[model samples]
Target: MLKSLLSDKPGARPLVEAIRACRWHLLAAAGFSALVNILYLAPTLYMMQVYDRVVPTGGIITLVLVTIVVFLALGTLAGLDVIRTRLLVRAGLRLDQQLAGRTLGRAMGSHETSARAGQVMREFDQVRSAIGGQGALAILDAPWTPIYLLFCFLLHPLLGLLTLVGALMLFGLAVLNERSTKSRLLKAHEASARAYAAQEQVSTRSEVVRALGMRRGLVARQLTARAEATGAQSEAQFTGGRYSGAIKFLRLMLQSLALGLGAYLAVQQQISAGAIIAASVLLSRAVQPIEQLVGAWPGLVQARAAWKSLTDLYEATGDQDEAHTLLPAPAGRLDLQEVSVRMSDGDTPQLKQVSFSLEPGQMLGVIGPSGSGKTTLARVVAGAYRPQLGAVRLDGSEYGQWDPERLARHIGYLPQDSVLFAGTVKDNISRFEGAADPAADQGAIDLRAVTAAKAAEVHDLIQSLPQGYDTPIGPGGRGLSAGQMQRVALARALYGSPRLLVLDEPNSHLDQDGETALMRALKRAAEAGAAIVIVAHRAGVLASADLLLVMNKGAVSRFGPRDQVLQALQGRGGPRIASVS
Candidate 1:
């Protein structure tokens, strides 16, 4: 069953395998469901006994004993139902425990757009809820519907026929419900997801929106999106609700008709008065599972969609089950050979045939006009994106040869935005390493973090804060100025004296003092034998650079010793390179 649901792709099996791992528990739940359904017959049987045997004989003690027996059965049924629910909930927790880390890792590493990434995690939560909630209970009970019909048949052939007809009609209604709402619900879900993504963007960039007087316009746009989503959802619900009402009406009418038919049978000497109530009870039970299933169909649909989305995402990302080679620490030598990257649509390559090499202790400055792919090259060297062609190697081995986590320990990257996470200054500097408790492994963490801060020349500035190293930074480094955030980000990159440092416009937000600090930090890193790549729009930040690479139209225009490249450009009138320098 699991194999049929999931493809044989490397990463695609985990989600299904997680459910398969709980097969025993599911079977046990099914067993409990069977017992519960059997116990459900006790009420009808007790009523029949009261109406036919006890009332005719006036046997009070007999009635009391039967009541006690049914009560005991009811109590046991309740306990079993609780146990079944707990089993399902525990299975869901185990699924989460087994797959949450891997899911989060894939979501974070996804090359998909921001909106798609947000939807991926939401889909995970939906799958979890559907598997563990009342929807699962309905599914478990659905299989026992045939047993209920059998009991109705034992009561009378005519009553059994009525139940089968009603069951089939309800089944038809369920099919109609599915067909009516499935597509509409899917559209609503997508629209809602997009609206939520936009709202998140507004929250994360609230300052930009408010400062630029775009708040009202953005809010109005959000309102329109939300209204459209709500309208689509409402339409689906209305369709489902119409079917639900029809099914409910059919169930009530069927139960009533069974009673009337039973009374007629009694008049014709075919059944007892007790048989009338019992027939009605049996008919309701026979169709109950179908009704519950129909009611839970929306959740089931959502789970199905989530399952497919996760399966496709896992296939795309591949699994991390294969062991990576444990290579020695890199010595900062960097090489890019015939490297090129293109859009997935096979558009022109963003970085075409870009090749470069930097030995240990060498500092390379990358300068280019906007859209010249300098940033793309820096990302390639930083291992953030793998090129479609050729290779990026550190110390002589391809980046793919090393474990990603191990490689990350020896590389530092400060992107153009210089973003910081929510943590104390020391915590951010340490990359959130060590225990949360101050007395735990924080001593070593603090030592290394402090050293990095000093190297970035941000230690004195941090010391001037109200809590010094422990000062808390809000989301997006909200508590700090742009220059301060950049300095802190630089310190984070410098932590543990990473062998390869990639900085994209690190000095963009810096004042003269901050720039001086940045220059000193670069010089110190180069002196420590770290291979460095710095992308800059201004030449002043490249004073310590030993080599220069100039990019134009996604291709390298000049590459050589920094002085030689600058001299050559000067001879060419340097207009093309003016903004770059």
Candidate 2:
């Protein structure tokens, strides 16, 4: 199962590639570490000579010189060790930045279904932690271990053979552990994803939960998800730990055997005492790096899993075609012909052969009962989704042919939930990326845009705040009420001065007075020659529209001038239409 999860994600290559691209720096650090190990190994040989040869010769001066040389060698190795550490740390930081950039870039285009933004963020953090922690050491140690083993073999081939066998056995055990715990690791990943999703949802809808008196229910659900995740993690750790313990035991036995054999050979005079001592020292040095690699196995697995997850997300979202050449702004003429949208299940269609058109500067209000596909139709018109069987044309040009950014410049879309970022009201209004217009500039405030805000009736509310337009709204504008948020959204839409505006349930949460203000804003926007299309439920809002479109079962059941549609609806005993001011 872990293998399946890893294989399922093709997007992981970029992350892996990013790491591999920094191999030169890693190799340089590994070289320095290897040099330090060699210097440190010299002391053991010199000490053995002092005991076995120098004392027999009674060479007191030679002993003093050898001791000083060993200390110098030790100091040199210590300096090199510091250099290697610094280099690896620097390289790891670079990798972190690269990973963060790649992850965030992928998040920008990732599919909504995959919940990619959060996933990418988590993966990027994991990759960073892995590199900064044991990951760099593992890279250095894995390759350096063989070099040390070769040095041991040069000291004495027999002891080298024994050490090689032990290392091989330890490696085999680690591989077995990895394979056995693979499924557990995958389960843990899935559990973590579910837990994160549940937590995020609970956080986002905390207010709703409290209002509906479902706080206990939400808390219970969150706890269940967290528990499941914790359990899965525990199981994975237990399984991995069992195999790790066994491997460590086997390694310890092998090291002991190598030490015993070396000492025996030295006593028999088959190998020089200095050679035996060097072998023993090299063997000891090998143990820590070997153990480190073994210990790093779990992190490697997790990094792989994270890599795969990121890859899957990127693949799913990155396959979109490049945006075409930018097209000129449309005349606000839109037409949808034989449009149909089928859900992924391919059984129930959300929209079926729906068609409509609006003349330039016209105000069209779409009314429908719940589940009548009103929002779906608006999304199709706004170019959020492509229809399965038809086309959406704006000013005689197909939406797909126009550059997405350019199309956005012409069409303003406000979804049911107006997402606000962590910024002041003015920042949200001027989301456009460019130099400030000199004519609109007023210190930190854009006076021209602020005038639009006043027209939208949100200007007074903003000024009432402690910082006025500069007040830092927390994430998602949590500081603002729903009505205030709606007006802010409207002001943002108007700030773009878009040729066409598509709003879905713009005033759903507004009070009567706020709704009146919204109507006035819409009338002003229409008078400015901006084509406005709104999905509305209230008769008061619908009555003010120049045209009314009533949708039923994914198709337009009635559409005409407001008065005609209202008269027909009243005659049919449908909802009464209110007067338009």
Candidate 3:
């Protein structure tokens, strides 16, 4: 899963391009932060001088002017700091927006695992936060630290040594913290991912659990997983925080020791009082950046871990070797040449050396017993999965050669369990395409005509409530019966007027009247020159077909015109059935 998040680097281009995009704002913010730090440090050093020598020299007016200058400098620094912060924040927001746009666009088109997508999204958030928060401080303080250190070294070498030691110690502490917590951090992240997956599973299948009276069991399992994950995370965070606190306390103690030593040197007259005072001020300034570095250690570690996870996700499932563009409407002819599919676990093949062909405007009925791979065959034809050793072709051209988007335009597939989104019927039918009447485009299929065709055959028994086609359907079309939902799915597929239509178990929940209406619609579609494939177990639906294919153990056991196939099945003592009531 982690393998899918690893995207090919945009090379030096994206990095430099992103920087250039926000360069002006970054420069302004950095410049202002430097000015603020310099002004902030100058007043403290000057105050030490005034106390140690200026007042003693009796320069009252000069001292007053200098004090005023300090206040004005501080005010300017404070104002600039605010402006800089706002500017950097805006720049960060813009950068995040741009990166997120690119990421989302890639995500939509790439066939990555869901786990990998989640990891990518998590990493994106971490990067965004870093830029907006600690990242900004790191940028400002990192550059300023050297300049401030140089000033301290000039003022007093002893103070400079102390500041250097403190910075080193802080760095050592952060490194130690990272090393100790890295494993725990990774474990915590794994736990979180599991908990999220569990929660999603429970939410997505809530109805099934409730109906099966397993709600309590499902909830218990979810809560247990969540609690375990929470405990792991809390333990990791607590351990890291305790270690950080200890380091901070030790640093503070060393700071006090440094100040005391500097004061003692001044009293011995080994150093000027002004020098001691300035040294103390500089030591404080030096420790500030170190403190911030220590404080940001946890976030940095977590962000790195997230980034690694994202890279791993990308590596696992990012590559797609079969990158053919989908073709426009297939010639309404499909041929499966000795196609076979095996489970990823290397179990017995689900489909094996199955070969069949449907001519343009033909209707093929697929029939089989339970677990005989009828639905699987339908999905194969629909291009949901690639057959291991064979090929699916449209109009004698390999199906993979067609662009996915263009192929979708020509082929309409309805799964056994049709799902509907939460929206008005029109909205669900149009999906991302806005609700311009589906009937408007020249070649556009009319969804209403599809519905009318089904209704003419008497399939649409119940009119949609409240607003007809505009009525809002609950998620998954929960308010509708199974048969009603099936009809709606049929309407959607017909609305596209696709050249090739694949319907899996469309008659599963339909009553006699509904089945009649559906058969009429299928006949109408066939008459309109669309190739139709139906996967079914019922004889009524099968008898209406132009051809029948009987599947057994992943192979086509029998195939011919409907009458001949039925006659053969009857000769074997199969249930004698009628084609239509």
Poorly placed runs, candidate 3 (over 4 Å): 1-40, 53-55, 58-64, 99-123, 274-281, 287-290, 305-328, 337-355, 369-376, 386-391, 396-400, 435-463, 548-581
Candidate 2 on 103-156: residue-level lDDT in tens?
A: 675576442445334556776566566665675676666666777788778777
Question: Which numbered prediction scores highest in lDDT against the true structure?
Answer: 1
- Cα error, residue 264 of model 2, in Å, equals 2.0
lDDT for 68 (candidate 2): 89
Q: What TM-score goes with each of the models?
A: 0.95, 0.86, 0.82
Candidate number with the higher TM-score (2 or 3): 2
Note the residue pairs that clash in candidate 1: none
**Which has the higher TM-score value, candidate number 1 or candidate number 3?**
1
lDDT of 1 by residue, 439-527 (tens): 66777888999999999999999999999999999999989999999999999999999999999999999999999999989988999
Taken over the whole model, the C-alpha lDDT of each candidate is 0.87, 0.75, 0.70
**Lowest lDDT block of 10, candidate 3:** 313-322
Alpha-carbon RMSD to native, per candidate: 2.3, 4.0, 4.7
For residues 1-581, what per-residue lDDT tens digits would candidate 3 score against the true structure?
Answer: 22332345432233335546777887888888888888878676677768776867988887887788888888898899788888778777776765565455445544333544544566667755665576467658766766767776776677677777777777677677767777777777677777776677677667888889998887798789878777877777887787679767866776686677778877777666676667666666766765675567556656666656544443442332235754445669888999998866558988999998998789998887777788889888887766778998888877667765566667777789977777766555544245334445523333544354353342334343556656677878877778777777777676557788899998888989788878888888888888899988777776568888888888898888887888888899653455543
Ordered from best to worst lDDT, the candidate numbers read: 1, 2, 3
